[model samples]
Target: MLETGATGPSAIVLNGGSSSGKSSLALALQSELPGSWLRLGIDDFIDALPPRLVGAGGFEVEADGAVTIGPAFTALEQQWQAGVGAMARHGAHLIIEDNFVSGVAAQKRWRKALEGVTTAWIGVRCTPVVAAEREARRGDRIAGMAARQALIVHEGIEYDFTVDTTNADPTTLARSIAHRLAR
Candidate 1:
């Protein structure tokens, strides 16, 4: 049975752009926070998408690292977000990984979905240049995406707190979030 309304925060939203170390931070946070926390992010959903919808049906990825979501992609994203909300409602502690590309609108959607759940929003910030460097080193992300999203992703969401990975390591950043959760 899912345990609803347990003590402390039941969900954490890590909002940042690609290559900002959100994934690493999530992992570090899992190690820092007590109990089990689930990670749900755009990557998870994107990976699950059918090949037909990956780059054309619902989403587009330009060579310059720009991404556009079509109507179909938007529809799928809604379902994914809803499911994450359901998981929270069922008492699972969630670590949501996202880039609020639509700015405030996207954050508002998540806020509404998680209205009754105790959710902590975290802004993961990294200077575009630094993020680009990280991206190049990682070798998995599309080039230039980090620079493209570094600023726009955090546009209008107010975070419980923000973490800068530009100089800090994931473990250090994770501890800060853990401290917030402890309070």
Candidate 2:
């Protein structure tokens, strides 16, 4: 079990690009971890929004392959990022999954929000080719998004650990992370 202090529960933040297997790792980690751990992600936040607002300010991929997210989506994303930290501080053992694009304001906001919590920053990595393949198979993501995000997500950040999803199975990776957390 995590050592709950004045700040509340501990957190593991999984940062990666689209199709990096963050959600799979989170599920595996939950199964391997000893105590209850809540899984939260951008999908969760997006799912919570009303249908009309879901894509209102979200990303758009142009014919030329450019991707852009509008201001309204950015604001909502920021709120969700901060809310993950708040949930941890309020006593939820959380595994937060996010594709943290570089130069985005939400990354800095997330760092600040998690300051007082017992947090581990984990990087989930995969080759762009593999990510693109996975994204294509999933069919839930915008085309070319994985390639675009692969270039920007991990910039200017350090992680306690990194898991490359390209070669390893989720269970194996989860067991490794669980062991580290147990130490």
Candidate 3:
């Protein structure tokens, strides 16, 4: 079993692009894990933001089809990630679902904050075609977000484990992760 450090609880970080089934897998893992596991994600932080700040130029699409985040949103996201780290340090068993942009400064911040903590870095993968279909069906995501995010999220990160959400069921994947955690 993964050991919880003296200062805090261990974490399972699920990194993926938009509509890549991170949230679904997080939920399934929570349900299957024996102990209490706090399921946290980008959406949780976003939901805490003021309604006016949420969609007010938080994201921008460039002429080259790249997406950029606004400064205001970036600050908020940084704070949110810091909070996640603080929680882990204070003994919160967390499952974090994040649609991370590879090579971003925030990625480095995450690495620093979770330093010395027992962390399982999981990559949630999905084909762009499947992600797009999922996004369209959800209707809660920004247009072209999946395609844009698919280009950047997993660029240089190495995963302790990976799940292809396009083909495997979330429950089965969760069970597999749980078994690994138990070992």
Which candidate has the highest lDDT of all? 1
What lDDT does candidate 1 reach at residue 173? 81
Off by over 4 Å in 3: 1-9, 55-57, 60-66, 102-104
Q: Over the stretch 1-183, how does candidate 2's per-residue lDDT look in tens digits?
A: 234345333888888888999999999999988789999987787677656564435655554334566777777777777777788778788888987763445557677777678887788999989998998999887778887776578886677878899989999999999877777
Which ranges in model 1 have alpha carbons more than 4 Å from their true place? Answer: 1-6
Q: Please, what is the whole-model Cα lDDT of each candidate in the order they appear?
A: 0.86, 0.78, 0.78
lDDT at residue 80 of model 1 (Cα atoms): 81
Which 10-residue window in model 1 sums to the lowest lDDT? 1-10
Error of 1 at 113 (Å): 2.4
Write the candidate numbers in order of decreasing lDDT: 1, 3, 2
- What range of 10 consecutive residues in model 2 has the weakest lDDT sum? 1-10
Model 1, residue 110: displacement in angstroms? 1.5
Residue 173 accuracy (lDDT) in model 3 = 96
Clashing pairs in 3: none
